[model samples]
Target: MIQLQSSAMQDTQLVSNMMYFYSNSARSSNGRQSWILLLPDLITQSRQQTRVAVLATSMLLLAIQSREERIFVESLGYYCQALISIRRQLPLVTDPQNPDFLPLTCVAIVLSFFEALCGTLFNGYYQHVQGAVVLLQIQGPRNCALVPYHSLFYAVRNHAICASLMTGKISPLAGEPWLTIPFSLSKKSSSDLVNDILLAMPRYLSALNADETASETSRMSREDIVQDLMNHLQNLAGIWSQISQHEHPIAESTQPTIPQSVELTQRYTYDNPYHAKVIANYRTAHLLAFSLLSIILPCHDWDVAPFLDDSASILSAAGYLEECDIGCAYFQMVFPLRLVAQHSPCATRRRVAIDMLKRWCGEKPVRGLANSALEAIYRGQCVIPQSPVYRNVYPDMSTEHSKACCERPVPKPFSYTAKGQWIKLDGMDTYITGDTKAQRAVLWVYDIFGFSSQILRGADILAHSSKEPILVIIPDWFRGSTAELSWVPPVTEEQQQKLGTFIQTKASAAIVVPHVRTFAKCVKAVYPRIQRLGIFGFCWGGKLVSLACQGDALFDVAAQTSPARVDPEEAKHVTVPMALLVSGDEDAGLVARYAENIRAETHVEMFPSQIHGWMSARGDLNRLVVWNEYQRGYQVIVQFFDKYL
Candidate 1:
């Protein structure tokens, strides 16, 4: 692995310089864009350089190399970055343009080379794979006028590739003795495993840097390279230590350095890197959703979901086989996977085993796994109705139907927002990520509501605004709210009046509530730096749109879809310039009475064919009604957001 990395690095400069030349000139000449004409020439060049990288990487692994190999890696890294940049500049094509082929071909080869080097250099660290995925993912959205869903999808795509590699699904090289290592799991925690892997790297690097054929070779000035690499390893080791410490607080940190060995056996002793990532992502998503008062899940086939292979019996059969810690604990709690562990006499082993089970199967926050957890470690306290959050808003909430299916209690504290081309006034953080492609986004989105989200935070109009920060409004008391699960009969005329008053009180509290109300609360604290606001919502959130409209007239414009129960009288209070998007069900007699007034009052679009929670339904197949509606609605929603706030 080390040898291959060394070899890949050998060609970085040469390849990067060539790519830069191609890119520097490719622009300003669409007439001359020719994949057929120039592609073969580039391939031939790649064929030779790739061979050098392969051999050099092999030599580096075997502990033999010329100083030349060391310089090669940096060069390769540079070129990969360049090719990534060029590919990003070209317009993404759906109809297969000629120029598209050229850039695509280059990106493929360039990324392959980059992956080879980074993969080998880092000893196949999953983070590098993830970074490589992100690097490739940023291309399309760079050309589009909206936020890049491609980046998100691309990340998942590469995740699949990496998963395959980790699982021994596909080999990087054919019929080669190399690429055989790092194919199994590591028994040591990832942090410990990293140190162990790096211990063997120096030897392969030494060979690659040394001139095996030069009998009298005495290499000098390579001190910096060696030190730089050691630094990299040390930094990685540090991160490993930190993550490990989270779960293993009681475990003593040892000074034992990872053994430096070229013949070490790869440990498939039960730790898959993807499992960790899936767990980490699950944890991150949980926090993100919890903070934003939303729910998120990885959109994929269950077969590919991390850790659990059988999918069924994940909860029942999964338990700890090893010692556990906070990191593992947090991971288990966050992802909806089954836990696997075993009872152990060994302390570390027992801890690990227990930790894994508790996390994946625990009930409190495992909202998604509630009913699904008959085989789980724990069970839900209660099962609520899968009704829309509009019961209080309508006399007959049955009019609007969204088949969300799960009746798990909603976590308390709710909020919503969308920032269309938001304006950033001054004094905000500047983050330059991926290709620096976002540089074209001079239009800052300061909208507190909507975000140009690829993650699909909102169940309504789907779009990404470059100007907006992800605006999320959280309702107070998210976990089992006063209104979260009311399995009551329809509101009576008298009850409707009473609840209308209740709605008024809630509305007044919301209207008057200060300090961390909408996502704008965060923005306001962070702003003067932030300017402009975009408001949006789905289901009951539509009501929030109305409330925000009444109070914040400065919100240039707002869009609401499938709103919750609205005070019929409050319709007269809406003052903000806005766009009202609602499903057919939301437009009723009284709600309908305000429709004309709403259209006259602001921008309004009614989707008569759609259900209220159409945006969030993850229906299996049946594209015409479910998928197409979401897609078309997403399109129009994006378009509407594109035109205004």
Candidate 2:
């Protein structure tokens, strides 16, 4: 390690290393406007504090590059000295005319990156950028149009937006003065244009994410905020379309085939990864805006197809960049890829994005920072209700208070064991309980969260009816392929993708319906003493129960709770009495249609406050309200079965 001296600053080896780091790791491929290009000159001309800060940043990068404990320890020493120097100089460098202003601001930006590299200092990055934001404001936006100042301003603006995104707070630089004044003299780049639009978003997000403590009159109407988000989505789409039109006109002539898998498709050829990088950024921005829209505006029944299409496009672009093998370009795609992993509803796309990010963690320069971001993703912090916009923002007391009131728990409770005995019903493992000699029998169908103890307990409760005991059998229809509890809330990208795949492949109507019918036949064959038969289903099982009830000879009556795919056309074929118990998550309009069309004696009850799967495996037994609802749902099922079966 080189000793800290003025001579060390001019050492050929040190200078070469610093230059390489800046060129490859610090700056994007578009280096013309990047602040990093000014570092070489600043190192020679800046004051002691500025010089030390730059050196500390270089040393940290070197330590990371070499993975040397000694180098890292040495870097820490310089970093502390640099911090002290900055604090000493900060009070005096307030004026833009002060010789140290530009260099100090640059040093602050460097420290922001330094904090990001440490990763342990989660708030340190934002704090440093916040100081720089203040310095930039003091410098005035007009003066920022000059040579080095222009570059520094851009750096500050970018860092500020990133900090704001992670914190879910409005960027101090989000106002119109900063947006228009800085770009008045110099024309903005295509990337700058995109960010300029994004800079306008934090204010809206902050408002939309306001806690319940926030005064109702103080907040903007949700409808108005939604309108703004819609406009932003459209504007971002337009910018991306323009970029496509300008960069790949010939390829853009035809509509590109939407990707259905993780495989990279050569839909549009890029001369360089930078073009793909820009496209991915724009697409992610649009997708994030749409995701927010979907969460806040639940009634719109927004077609998830376009949202998925954009996700696929993002993956395609990222996959293309990975093939290009340009390390710097890969960093450019980091934000976009993270967005896909956090926001994309498609399981395949989310899994692919996560895998790519994991691969990049070892190869990227900002490995610590990347790892920290991945930690947040794995923790399922990014997909919480109004997330991805809120990204890694930790909730404060107010935020937590608001969340507790409205939000459903992630990974809703699943009991590990069931009370009933497991017995084979003609070769199929079934949860059998209650009186075997009873006249009535119920074939219980579980949801995608197959055979959880909650559902089994509900079955137990239904079976042990004191006045009229009935035989209950819950066959293992999923055959151990039940949706994993980890994917309940589907927080992480991989989990989301896994859940999606499980639904389509394992739990789909086409695959599960035949097994259900077969299970019903097997149950009847095994329990020949039963005079009448009934079927009860929960969530995905409810959908299958509905399908099975369509002129099926096996069941005398049917009931479902939190049912899926409630088509009215299928209701007309229901040959027996049917009960529909649903949560707020289901489409009431569709449920209404089923009731209107059903020929059988129909019982429709809506638990509007409860989440879907409340009566099944996803219910949180810990919550008193949810537990009450869970008990009531089973009681309803019992009464309906008693009356008809």
Candidate 3:
């Protein structure tokens, strides 16, 4: 234990001693524990060292221990390492590709699982696969003890996927109430959750694919992948729910969440030492089942490009990157099939599919689409009867007034148009159109809510600003899945490319600002004589707008809320104006810091609260409402546009 800093300590002696200790420990190895005890505790050690060393140590230690010990230690190491990496610095964890954050080791818990089981008549709930992994590091040790917490997190976040939620996947009414019974995972529960979720997903995808197919191929459509995925999700959900919750369903009425005889299997049989190994097997299954379900359920419900994109956003929030990647691949795979479904006109199945997607994406169509299937509920043509939102301070306010919509005759906003169709910068069909509308045009953005779609609470800046001859830059993939997109087969790569390309074409709506340098070109092209313009965006689009404005002359005014990315240096570069809108309850501290950085460097409007979907839409979870109470963001947007745009 000599000090490591001294030059004289170029210590072969230390290495020799460590090796001796390692070898001796093998003689009476407590397995992983003995090895760990002999070494510098990796958990407490500083992380200037490479991660391979940590993985290597854990792998070898696990090899020496009992199955139970090995599994637990392995999980512990992965979780610890994941936490460590997040705490240390790296680029912010907004993008999935960030290296400081991909924690495959923690994902070890979900490697294998037997996702088949009878319901114990109970229930379920997973977040950010990228930055969330880091946030979970800051989440501290609450759920880090073993596999259960990760399993719980995975299940909770992916509750829809786990149960195979059918909303937005089938006819919206297919599972309107989700169940005939009051299904609860606890005494407070009762539901046919498993069945409803599984059934709704494929039904919707089938409808989507069927709608897109030509009259000839409509009759010849092949395998039902939506049903297949739902079955898989149901199987996994039932099995893991049974095991984790300790219940088995012998009755048809009982839709158990875990597996039958599960706890015993995981606990011990007194049946044999092999019981422990069996426990490891079950633990592995439990973890995998939950993780996969988290990913698959949301995907199962929404195959439309907008919904798929939304699924990605939800996955990022739930911290299911591995699942997100898998979901993205699946989306690519089945894309073609769904496209065919979407091609069909006014078929009952297609209608069902659209409804299901609406539920999942929290999309309640404001206006009816042109398709006959949606004719019954079409609100697009008719002025939708504004639903009254209940609140504490104000008398119940209608959603119409609650949203701070930008004023009509929105002063000319800065406009930029792109030459080609919207090209996907990162899986979005983004188009920007702005030309000397305001001294500087300000843009409003959202993740899943596109300009043409229903409004999200107070986020009607685009629609409400009908008076303003503003150039509206609408990105194609804002919602990930939309009514138009649902009809496309999202399972095929060719289809994905085609659809992605089509969406990208929308960029022709405005000047294509592909790179930071080209952005200035867009500004120059649009505002050769103008002096100011503002840029605004939401969700993924919000992130994009924020990034695009970084140190560029294209945007004179900018407002990004619920943004996915932030570049602080952009503050110094931004010459004109900017603002950030955030509301509801979720924390925007990280983004707020960026805002502060901007304020430190320049003046910008900023909303320090959480507005779910920027009050652009509603968020539904197992029927519980989170952001159904407000719609003032629209008003805020309107005011911002008035002041800056």
Best candidate per TM-score, number?
Answer: 2
CA shift of 599, model 2, Å: 41
Query: lDDT order of candidates, best first?
Result: 2, 1, 3
Question: lDDT of each prediction vs. the true structure?
Answer: 0.34, 0.70, 0.33
Tens digit of lDDT per residue, candidate 1, span 1-645? 223355345334333433342233222111222221243344345433333333332222222123355545654554455444544444443332333433343344333333332233332333333433333334332321122322222222323333332222221221122112222221233422332322223232333345756334233234444454445545554554544322211112332111111011111111332233322332222222121111111231212221222121122112211122211122222222321221111222223333443443332212222212222212111111111212223333322222221121222222334333223223222221111122111111111112223213332233233233333322231212222122112233343333334333433336422312343454444434334555555544555565555654445556665555544556666665555556665545545544544433465566677655555422211446756666655566556554664
lDDT of 2 by residue, 113-157 (tens): 677666536567778989899898888988887777887887788
lDDT of 1: 0.34
RMSD of each: 25.7, 12.1, 21.7
Better of 2 and 3 by TM-score: 2
Q: What ranking emerges by TM-score with the best candidate at the front?
A: 2, 3, 1
User: Model 1 off-target regions past 4 Å?
Assistant: 1-518, 527-529, 598-601, 617-622
Error of 1 at 559 (Å): 1.5
- Cα lDDT for residue 460, candidate 2: 84
Of candidate 3, the 10-residue stretch with the lowest lDDT total is 112-121
User: How many pairs of residues in model 3 come into backbone collision?
Assistant: 161
lDDT of 3 by residue, 219-256 (tens): 32233443444465556455446433322113334432
